[model samples]
Target: MKALRKIAAQAGVALEEVPEPSAPQGTDVIVEVEAAGICGSDLHVDDWTPGYEFMVPLLPLTLGHEFAGRIVAVGPDVEHVKVGDRVTVMPSAPCNACPACRAGDSEKCQNKQTLGLRRDGGFAPRVTARASGCLPLPDAVDYELAALTEPLGVGATAVRVGGVGQGDRVVVLGPGTIGQALAIFARLSGATDVAVVGFDDAPRLETCRALGFDQVYDLKEPGAMDRLKSDFGGCDVVFEATGKAVSITDGLALLRMEGVFVMAGIHEEDARFPATDFVRRRLQIRASHGARGPEWRRVLAAMAKEPEIFRKMITHRLPLDEAVRGFGLAHERGASKVMILPGQG
Candidate 1:
């Protein structure tokens, strides 16, 4: 099998001929990957960013977690999902004995094993994962869109954490894949006013606008903030999806008193914010991590309800052999969601 791997502690990924994965004992399933999505976390690992030291020990690992595939084999204990099922796996698997997992908060389990980060992932034709993590895809969702379920699940979790509801005003900072997903989920949660802000006039910003976002603002433009304030009054929930520290401060500034701030991006460094302002405003800060089982169900249902919009977010697709080029496109500013067809080429 050909797989894309992070072969060194450097700023690139290499495609190499590797042994095809097989299902081992203990409820594992071997999936023949159809499509995989290049995510922002993959970009961080490709660039060897500061917070990615965790990848050092897992060097030479296959680098994809957002993928959907057909099951070719399963261990003896795997009965719920069978061979030939089309599915997408949750990106992380929790140690069932952990305190968090025991209490049904497996997303916070300290002993969780992440797919692309800790083990071999779906950047190849075949990958092995625990059967417990796989979710069967509905007939309405195809492989390409099924590959997006994990990220959309993350967005749903963020919206749930932020307590977004009918008639609430919402603001999302950054128009990347996660940012777009955040906006979609917020609107689905019945937010009456939704605005997305970005520093660059990237293709993603336009993508958000095309997705019918009420307000899409380029921060570099004059009077952007004034327009935002004028349109939405003040934000009841602010989702900081840009990972940059400046976005945190900007989101705080946009948030109304006692508003909820959801940190939905993965930051590579310590982010600074005004403690006094946070206290004075009585703001609530919630950090959203990866999605769990319940959130995955919600995201899949959303995909079923609105498949066209989800399909529109997929702007680029490449063969697995062109993964290096695909990574380049994903890292570029304008690319929306890049998909790698593993079975092709």
Candidate 2:
């Protein structure tokens, strides 16, 4: 079987003819992957970005974290899920011996190994995942939409952290998949108005518009920022999902005094912002990363309830043989969410 892998401590991923995975081990399940999404973090790994040095020792690992599939085999200890179950696997696993895991807070596990990053993951037709990380899918959601749970979970966490509420106006500082997810959840959280912003991102910005966000902007356009300010100034909450430090200044400028600003993106460098103004405004800054177990269930339920709405996030699809091309499309920002169908030719 061929799998997409980061074979070295440098740029680019390779498709290698690797042997099929052995049978499942303790508490693990072997899933026949149906759909996998190419994420920004995957691009980071492919480009050999600065923050991913921890993966240096874990090179040659298969590179996909956001995926959903059916379990072909299950370990002896697995009970909650069984073979033939369609599920989306959470990429992160915690060592149960950690204090946080012992307290039922696995999200804070002192020793955590992410499946796609630290271990082999679902970039191929089959991959092994811990049974605990797998969530059974609802009848309404299929494999492609189910694959979106990870990124959507990320957006859901950002909105919850920002505390978006009824009648609140919210601004999202990126038009990528996560940013789109933030906008969707903000509306679901009862925010009456939501604005999404992008920089020379017509494709993704158009995707935002397609997702029902009317106030979409491309900063490259003349007077676009002015128009955004006129329309959404003094907003109640702002979400920075661009991963660019400079967006902090722009997002804060639109926020009302004491309004919440949530940082949901993974930055590659340090961010510098105005100190005096932030102090005077009494603004609050919050950080949102991966979602917890309950948050995952919530995101999955939302997708199940309105699967078509979430399905729009997927704009491109490719077979496993062409998975590298999918990576390129994602890196160039030419596609919103590219699905890699390992089972498709």
Candidate 3:
């Protein structure tokens, strides 16, 4: 199996020939890799030490988690999915016996095996999965969008955690894929005015206008914060998807009285905030972790129904061989989602 691994710190990923894994024991499935997405966090793999599954493989680990593949084979005990079934792996195979799993917080399972990060992930010809990790996709959804389910799940989880609701005003502080997904979910929650904060993507915003976010602001524009306050009463809920310390502070500054701020970005390190704002307005601040199985499935269903959003979100697609180029392009100005197919695109 030719797999890409994080071979060196802060260096480009390297391709390697690794042994093909065996079939899962008891109840499991083996999926033939199709499309895998390179996530922003995966770029941070240079310094990231896997916390939950640290004992699992680390360096030289296969470097993709978000993917949709075909069920080439399944263990005898598997019943939910069949060979040749088109499916998307949840990217998480949790220990269902753990307390968090029993409580429906599978992301917090005491013993978790997060694909890509913990196990040999999807950046190969094949990845062995627990039958539970595969979510069969409807024919309406294509493989590229299927690989995007992971990032959209992150936004959906943030919406759930932030408690954004109908008639409320919301602002998403970033124009990246996660911010775009968060904006879509905010609109779904009935936010009267959902402002996507950035102008880098005039085109993405124009497409978003088609999806129905009324107010779009470019933070790069002078006095943008004032414009936001005038239009949306200072934002009932502000979400920080940029992961920049400055942007988090900017989000805090824009929050209305008693407003909540959800940090949806994965900042690699500590960031300082204005404690005075907390003292003055009693602001509620919280950070959202990646969603678990149920949230992930909802994101897939939503994408299936609205291909329009996926169309606007996915900007670039390349073959696995071009992954390094794809990663470099992901952060380029005006980029949205960059997807990588394991084989020919």
Index of the highest-TM-score prediction: 2
Tens-place lDDT per residue, model 1, 1-345, is 899999989899999999877545779999999999999999999998887787787788998999999999999888899999999988688878899999998667887778888899999999999998899998999999999998888888899999999999999988988998999999999998889989866578888888888589988889987887777655799999899889888888888889999998888778899999999999998999888789899888889888998988888999999999999999888898999999887
After aligning candidate 3 to the native by TM-score, how far in Å is the CA of 69 from where it should be? 1.3
Candidate 2 regions exceeding 4 Å error are 97-104
For 81-161, candidate 2 gives per-residue lDDT tens digits of 999999999999987788999999877997788878999988999999999999999999999998999999999988999
Listed per model in order, the count of residue pairs whose N, CA or C atoms clash below 3 Å is 0, 0, 0
Which residue runs of candidate 3 sit more than 4 Å off their true CA positions?
46-57, 95-107, 199-214
lDDT of 3 by residue, 192-289 (tens): 77888774557656555655665787766788768876776667899988767787777887788889999987665679988987779989998897
Per-model TM-score versus the true fold: 0.95, 0.97, 0.88
Find the 10 residues in a row with the least total lDDT in model 1. 225-234
Model 1 has a clash total of 0
Task: State which candidate, 2 or 3, has the greater TM-score.
Answer: 2
Clashing pairs in 1: none
